[model samples]
Target: MRKDIHDYDLSRHNTFGIHATCRRYIEFSDEADLIGILASLTEADHPLFVVGGGSNILLTADYPGTVLHSAIRGIEPMPYPTSADDILVRVGSGEVWDDFVATAVSHGWYGAENLSFIPGEIGASAVQNIGAYGVEAKDIIYKVEAVEIATGSCITIPAANIGYAYRYSRFKDEWRGRYVVTHVTYRLHRRFTPHTAYGNIAAELQRLGIATPTAAQLRDVIISIRRDKLPDPAVEGNAGSFFMNPIISRAQYESLLATWPVMPHYDVDADRVKIPAGWLIEQCGWKGKSLGKAGVHSRQALVLVNRGGATGADIIHLSDTIRADVRTRFDIDIHPEVNIL
Candidate 1:
């Protein structure tokens, strides 16, 4: 296996920029290559894990298992079998997620504009159900194709078959180590319908003096918003939005709202309300503060950054401290959106 590299350095692979290595690292260019690697691994009885752009993960320690990565990259326009106003596009797993969004916007395609500037690849996009500005990947994903690692069998699963929720799918849980995503089919609208209701998108659009904006314009606004808030991984060594927003019952939200009148919240449903994790973290006085090499990002309290030379343990310690403080203060549990491995 010429593609298999031993004692592979993964310090540059993950966005957290943590120093870690794997026993073996294999890069597969296509399904045939993936099948070959899977077959070999299956016979060898070696533990394995699949990785994408490495944007949404925190490497806590050197992996003891073989790390399989996809090199499959391409975007193809599929036949639009549905209405005339909708189109289908199949994207390879290794394609950069933001690049695909940019392509869609450039072509005047809707639905992905609000997802602009999100990190990671197309495979993780569908798997993680990555979202921003009120738009989630599940909303646009039509079908997903993956290769079973144990059997080397390829299967195409429709969107309906995939259980999608806030920042999660079966790929993150039950099917986590079982399948390696090969491609994702996205159904996008040909007609533009801007979604600027969430966050400060509407106000930003107004501030920019833009009305009836195009997809590209909307993407630009999103990029600007992200740049203004989130820290760049290249410079800061972080996975954006380290914690998922905590969803509480409406009764719980009401109880907290009585104490803090201005606490921001979003209605998840009649039963639940979503509270910003950043606010909770900031309230705990962890914002822009550091514990050794690990620090809470100043601009976005939700992000945990490596000041420099921060090990995985340092981050975990800092995160634990923040979580404990939030629980003590708000009686809420905020969990990491970034996968800690």
Candidate 2:
């Protein structure tokens, strides 16, 4: 572990290129260093925040406390063949998500292929419950190993207990930073089971002339489609998706459906349905809308981008405007998917 602060620039660290200074910055190599650093901070003095890949966060203010960069990296492949056709493999949390998908496809391991090109480390994936196309991280996640910050102890939770949903987790909603994820174990497959059920996935597959696609080919398609749609955080300082697809009750959905026949929605569970926030944003004329450097991406209305040099407050205000507009137009509230600091 090393404690460095003098030359650190947060603009490059965060996906949203906002320039904010941290009071203190520390990097740890393993769990031992993590414990030491946490132990060093006093209750009121230490506002210990975990930063994993810095993809799904917006730095809205100058941090007054310490920032711990999660660098715990190692992938342990545990293969289990549950018959002649099934194969499962577990991955590490600190590993790069896209790299993990690439390796899985190379080895013919097949669960995370659909989530290719998604940014951030594998550790942060569970918190955001990252999903796209016709697949989600929760679908293949078997278990997650994490260390509780309060008691300085480690624990493992099953996929069922993680409270998996469309871009949500117990870690994000209820337990925020109660635990720092150490490793993630996913149960992948061997056979080629292409999940091209999503709206454009099938069309893209047909265009590529691939009837029976391999795991690698699926990763390629997902990466290509995402590159075309979502702006790369490296180039355009922005998180992939700003707001979550709002989930509403069946009654509310039915009412909306009755009013606007073309309103898009997906059944989340038996009682609730998820409505696309993008539809609401596009309806309100937010697509490509600009206010100084802070504006909503032209291609994707759900994504709020930093065009040049925008303040955190500028972005926050834009978000508020979009939220207010969506509510006024659709009578549905929109919640940010990215964590606001």
Candidate 3:
């Protein structure tokens, strides 16, 4: 089925909770419905924006074009060789991402446990390549099934063709607004291999006195860690991790390290390193600081929160201020991870 509304209120559609609306909002629950809706679209719906779960966007103003949301839902296991150690499962794009991860762990499926509580839907997971702990969606994704917005033809794109990178995919670049994802197939392990070294997972596990943790145990640890750090969107109107950690040259890292002495970094390659944007933001004194109605999240500097009734422009202003500070102080440029419109 499909639901089409004109001049739709989008405050609930976006996680930022901005008071905004679009010229049109079209939601479809199945492929046929999506195809039919697309076929009937007029020139009024020329420009389109696709959103999933609304956890990764910041709406700045009333949109002048159509906004498409997927309501398609399902999860089905695909048959594979009985002796194979890994299993393949097909999931609807509209399925809640964390719910899928929970189900996977419940059924003894591995590889997704480390990504336990990240927000957004399965479709957006592929689009954003959402990651947590040490696992990215691309690590388990096998193929992506989508509909070409222009041709209205179904396309099954192999994961190898997605061009996955840190917090990005082709769906966000050259393929932006070109396709609507319908389903994603993931290759999951039947055997559990724990990824506990990244972040504080190992420490959390050790604190719980679990040397060899189960999938469920690991998932719980990740959930607990995230809950302690990030705010709930329902209670606080904000998108998580407002900025992407900037990657810089090794020489640049050394120069900054000499000045700060306590700078933390991760190796991206021999010549490049990824610096934590949150650390930089904190050093600039933005953490827990408010600019107008927008503020940096008190616990995690990477997040920007709606202190109350903040407009999209307010959030942008806060982000801009922080970006300028970081640039001036560290000479490292940070970019937003959230999609802003």
Candidate 4:
């Protein structure tokens, strides 16, 4: 357990690079350390917020509560039963997500290669149901290990019990701030089942003159595609996608399609259709536009970048303006994927 700091700066902790401070910040390096910290804070009055990787949150302002971070790190491949064709790997919550994906690809582990370069840590993956291309975290997650915040008891829950959906999980809902995730177990296949149907992975690979893409090739292509579309947080402060693609009824999509003939959409189900939020923002003429130091990314309108010295409010204002315009112009409501703190 690290000594707590008072008024700790969080500019570097979050990907948006917001200059917010917390009243108290504590970091635990391992499960034992985390248990100790939780036990110590049980009688304390300040509210607790646990964060990993800091990639999915937008700090709106200085926090008045205690902030918790887990630094526990490791990835261990567990033995698989002879009857099963899959392998189970247990990972610490603090391990970098991309690094784990890279390791899996190198060792011929499938399923996660399509999720190649998505940011955040292993712990946040299940919480956010982080997905890319055609794959989501929920698909491979076998179980999650966490410590209850209230009682400091460790519990292992099956992935099915987490109530996962597109970009959502129970961790973000009823269980929010109630547990500190310690480890995640993923079931991956020994065979590489390439998924290039979503986005431009297939076309991009073809453009690169590759007729058949291996697991590593697919991973590399996905990383390249993301790099071209999304700004690096190190260079320009931004989350990958600021808005969740709005899902509407099929009737509503048909109504909009009649007005905008070139609109792109996908069927979420028999009655629901999903439209790209980026295309909607572009249609509203907000792409590459800026308000103060916040701007829509030139390459991808779904990303809102910090044009240096941008505060949380600046980004929020820009998002609000875009949301209102989208609703007024298309009668669709686009919500944010980034968690606003």
Candidate 5:
């Protein structure tokens, strides 16, 4: 219920350590408080911004309007006439994404096991359809609830309407800045199937010496693998993976395969093939290459890290150079996974 200016430097707040400022910033704790704040806003005068864990973002300049820091936090079972085995968890937008995954796995929830250690929040996950290891967020989402910024009306948008794809959702483009996600409802089953077919998941399970691995084992193994693969934001400062794996036509992939012969790829569609951006980046020799405190991660080529005191402009410049180089060399455009603001 108070509106006052505070030290709003977004450097420490955002995962990238980009020094940027917001004009007005406010944090709220619950749904009612969010609703109350929304009711106070004048529709045309206030341009709204909602920030979650500040993981997958880069701020180029100071905002000229209100920045609403989403803090609606909790996890509760959805009320309904349903079977006991069927569970629906409502998570606050501010809930740490990876922590939520850990909780679900510990509770024997099956859906989020492959998506361990991803950054950002529960609500932002749906908007971006965050994916890793073998799973995507939309795979288990039941529904997403949001408060309309313009009118302060609450809505339960079904998961199908989200238009999920590889690192994308309708929310990223069409519904951008349209809603402040209050909570997300996910249906995780008590007795469920497991996903262990992708990447090193099977190998990790074997290394753990389990014929039949429990959900906890899978979670632990995945966390271990990602810990080794990705640089921690606490030390090096990163926004996880920097680029989306580019999907090209099968003919196009075959052309590259004909040249490289050992080119690895996965089927994205009937004609489209998805290639690892890391492989492409490493081919370009950008991994561990530094330019003015911003560089590709030495350990993982897919991740762009702030080695020290890099500004937003510095990171983007590095990214632009990478993208342009990749496009020129391979004739394949590399798109950034992180959203630039």
Candidate 6:
């Protein structure tokens, strides 16, 4: 249930296709194995990093510490539902995220359909608070089960205490290196309530002649839209949505709007507005452009690609160039969504 290797090749671990290695690599398939491995660790494993699916990270150099990955996998529906309208399902951290969405949709479960096709794993979903369309993982997450890395004690934390925010969770910040997520429980609705108002979902449905879409149809529409915009990591090396959309004050947004007159924006609240980072990048003339081996994806300017043999540094360079330009032109700073390590 556990495999430990020294001086491990990590090229296949990350989606970026960056050639890198680590001091050690450990994969555990169950909670007991994880506890045993943690108990046996020495100072050699000083700085440990946990990765899942490796879809949202950019490895900048060879890691000098141990890399932990979860191989534990399963999906189980909890018996004795407390609510007739909803059901709770527990999913292993190592399970592919999209696969879980697919299963949920196939079984007539709602809530997760809006997040269909987003990459990464269930564990990463809880950590990243992954969202797409209009729904975030926090909206459906009932609880998170994890093991404290220091004490190897299993603990279940409810969603309310996780401090969920926009593309963020306590796990990514103050709780970093404190625990490794093993499973996530989600509350799904039995009655299908499709959220098609956000983005182009409704428009796409209308174009396809679907007035009332089933969960499967909605998922298909989202997948089609994503495929049209984002490049496959398998075919081209890239982290999806390299930048997080910048949220600015309403006054700032209004001032910028006066000059551009047609700038796209989303109202975050009464005081703030979310500006699309892709639109800003494209306006700065980085879309479909290249800096060495790293380039901006033509369709989705938010994505930075490894054109062929791009290194992590090459991607960083390209990102830096775009960030600088965006700052100079708009007086706004855009940050990367992908973790750089």
Error of 4 at 36 (Å): 0.7
TM-score for candidate 5, residues paired by index: 0.94
lDDT ranking, high to low: 6, 3, 4, 1, 5, 2
lDDT of 5 at 240: 92
Per-model root-mean-square deviation over C-alphas: 1.3, 2.1, 1.2, 1.3, 1.9, 1.1
Q: Residue 96 of candidate 2: its Cα lDDT?
A: 88
Model 6: residues with Cα > 4 Å off, grouped in runs: 79-81
Residue lDDT tens for model 6, 201-315: 9999999999999999999999999999999998899889899989999999999987878888888899999899999999999999999899999999999998888899999
Count steric clashes of candidate 5.
0
Clashes in predicted model 1: 0
Candidate 5 clashes between residue pairs 3 or more apart in a chain or in different chains: none
lDDT: worst 10-residue window of model 4: 39-48
Cα-based lDDT for every prediction: 0.90, 0.82, 0.91, 0.90, 0.84, 0.92
**Candidate 3 residue 264 C-alpha distance from true site, Å:** 1.4
Which of candidates 2 and 3 reaches a greater TM-score?
A: 3
What does candidate 5's lDDT look like per residue over 252-291, in tens digits?
Answer: 9888876788887878779999999998998999989988
Please say which candidate is ahead in lDDT: 5 or 6.
6
Which residue pairs come into collision in candidate 2?
A: none
Residue 134, model 6: lDDT of: 79
What candidate 2 gets wrong by more than 4 Å, as runs, is 1-3, 6-8, 81-88
Please state the error at residue 54 of candidate 3 in Å: 0.5
